[model samples]
Target chain A: MTLPAEYLATPRLPLDEDGGPVFSAPWEARIFAMTVKAHEAGVFTWGEWAEALGAELAKDGDGSGETESYYDRWLAAFETLLTAKNVAAAGQLADLRKAWDKAAKATPHGKPIVLENA
Target chain B: MSAHDHDHPHDHDHSELSEIELRVRALETLLTEKGYIDPPALDELIETYETKIGPRNGALVVAKAWTDPDYRERLMKDATAAIAELGFTGRQGEHMVAVENTDDIHNMVVCTLCSCYPWTVLGLPPVWYKSAPYRSRAVRDPRGVLAEFKVELPDDTEIRVWDSTAEIRYLVIPKRPAGTDGWSEERLADLVTRNSMIGTGLALDPSSLEDAA
Candidate 1:
């Protein structure tokens, strides 16, 4: 499938390659799809996402200039936009983060990590 | 693009979870609970990237390239069209470049700006690829990173590092092993590992396959 052509405009980031989206983990794909879905739903404009994501990318100002947790930065930008758009509350996200951490700790390995109360 | 320093989820053990795994789960739960994301759709998406589209596709391409000289030339001349010829195209791999590993030079891929990997062919970028250490160091010290991966090239072998981005993706066509002279594409495909295609490791040797078989 052809990717959205608008994504081609992102100058610095587009030194990209072809084929469908790939993620190292399920969550990476989830978050990536979510962002695209949200944009499609008009939750926020692409410009809005770029600005928000740009700010997050620019935060690591150490001039040594490195890429770290690319998806983590993406997640942060998504969170920022979601909250700014009031789609989800910041405190709610925080609470869920803690809850998952607790749930994950309680669960054994190789088992599907689920939040019973979530 | 390659394996991580720490153990990630594999077929054998899913017990040891990373912090990112936990955080991702948390985020998913929160988003799902808030009705921001549809659980069914997310599942489909994950399943697609996880199993439906991954390194296996690239393996097919590599295997075919290994067995067919004409296909290899086409792959080198135009990876996108060549890859598409085998029916692997879409999202993370709209623009594809295949770099061949030769006796004189080895090619490695890293996205210093972000984990810009050829997801369609590679499955997912490994956790280590996205890690800050690998991103920064892969460029500064390719030989050191190769050493850590147990891939020691001779001093005369030049290493060409390809930096990926959102627009283009790269696949490393590892040199075929010696003993597989008349191997079929199917058998050759098994020797093409994700790591081998990323230039972090070499293709499995025939002797190793014999031992395993």
Candidate 2:
């Protein structure tokens, strides 16, 4: 599905200055800028991203030269970036994965807390 | 508009929740009864979040970015620390990240997996944002969706869509509006609508505020 023009034309605030595009509010912008800075500093490269993403997509055996499957590829690329940069150690990521698993098990169906009071 | 004039059921009468709220409550109850969560604890958590870390905090952060260039720079680099600079970091925003827009590239964020947002800075994701229409369309055709919201960008701009799947969350920093020279941060914050921060609209100008009034 193509993104709507209205969504595209929305003037992005974070992009106002040459620094970078803010993802959400200023705080979110700040974190994104840091990530970009890190990427530019040779902490990671796009090739690593492509490789990681390629590997992840390969698991499904559907890497039929489709760009859409690149989403998983991007995720894998980011995982590699994090590991290479020590932004997250493999052990730490594993622990987080385990915690997420536990949380999912404890709260299956993913009901949001917003509806609890009724 | 004055906060008092805004017709929020929660502010006026707690007993009369909106239909959305009612559905949310029903879902909560179902989840609890089905052994998905601890009802009372979740209720307390939700209440604590709504009362202490809602839209007001988001407004404050946006306002600060508008007024303070140094702070804005810090915010664009380390959102968690920058927001913490204002003492607004907590919960969902503990791992907050920011994305900046440039002339060549524009950033749009979505949680295709779920409604993961920097709630500490953005409060709640609007109903439309969580809709399947938005999720499925945002990354694929952002320009068209933005147009529906009345935000039209130049064709030359490259769109970079970010999907929030991990604990890391995103927020958009909107451009400072025109014709607001020497405005205080507090006033600027008032002009920073949630939609602007979500990259769905631009900051309101004085004329738009007058029209709204």
Candidate 3:
């Protein structure tokens, strides 16, 4: 459950004088910037994330917070943020979940498969 | 009434469960009863993927990139389109992007939330890539994670970690390996490994394979 060091530390990218992470390749800086912006926008408070993450970690029966789980906690936080912000109408998220479930069930590869009729 | 309990023979509580949960439970039970869901079989399948399919698919993509400049450029800019150009686009690869390695920069990819991998392009994700251990660690200590995979970058090289979200999937475009001069695309493709495409390992050279042989 030990986390990798790179995940824990913030990366320093080559930047111009204004100090923005430079993007030499496609979509690299955009994704990084979005992550940073999402954090700053009060979409999900870091404290809430830490608490939820700590709870999940505790479920592993490991007291140490050394390990960090992938996107589950973030998804949960995003869901909460969406709910709080009223971004979608009531039950939209639930509908999407149901659709995803149906798609997973219908496809052998656990993806949404489209079958064309002859 | 409690002593007899005849009227309560079938529990009504089962009807209260969610449809998805009920369906899942029923499917699991049916599969188990049919003897089609053996734990050993599942383990074997997992092992096969971990040992074979993942790496093979990765190698093919890397080799193609190494030998074909146009393909490599397309992959770097619009991965899904580029992969479709090669007639290998569907399923998990519907939305894909490629991250390229350069002289001063290195790239690594991870699914920070769930194991949302581009399986069509890479066949299957390795056990480490899908494991909680790797997912949690890769984001925080990419260099350390790469080290575990035996990929050590120079100190001067900047590392860029790509987090694959629910919408978009990512593939790592490893820098073309040395000693592959005048090799065919097919030969180059043979040197591409799944780990290389995932940015955990480097692509092999045809000369290296020749040396080993």
The numbered model that scores best in lDDT is 1
Off by over 4 Å in 1: A1-118, B1-55, B113-115
lDDT of 1 by residue, B116-150 (tens): 56766777656566667887788899999999999
- Provide i-RMS per model in Å: 8.5, 16.2, 18.2
Best by the DockQ measure? 1
Query: 1 or 3, which is superior by TM-score?
Result: 1
Give the per-residue lDDT digits (tens) of candidate 1, residues A7-118.
Answer: 5443233222454454444456767777776677678888888888888878857533222355678778888888899976768777776777777567554244557785
Instruction: Say which prediction, candidate 1 or candidate 2, comes out ahead on DockQ.
Output: 1
**lDDT of all predictions:** 0.71, 0.54, 0.53
Please provide TM-scores, in order, for all candidate models, with all chains considered together: 0.54, 0.51, 0.52
Residue B155 displacement in candidate 3 (angstroms):
0.8
- Candidate 2 per-residue lDDT over residues B1-213, each given as its tens digit: 111121223221111222222323333333344453464444333332232223456667777877888887887777778888887766334356666555665667876434366666776455567677898799889999989999888999887676654355677777777888898888788887777777787778878777867
Looking at candidate 3 chain A, the ten consecutive residues that score lowest on lDDT are A109-118
Count clashes in each candidate, considering only residues at least 3 apart in sequence or on different chains: 24, 52, 18
lDDT, candidate 1, at B20: 61
Sorted by lDDT (best first), the order is: 1, 2, 3
Off by over 4 Å in 3: A1-118, B1-41, B49-58, B112-115
Q: Which residue runs of candidate 2 sit more than 4 Å off their true CA positions?
A: A1-118, B1-53
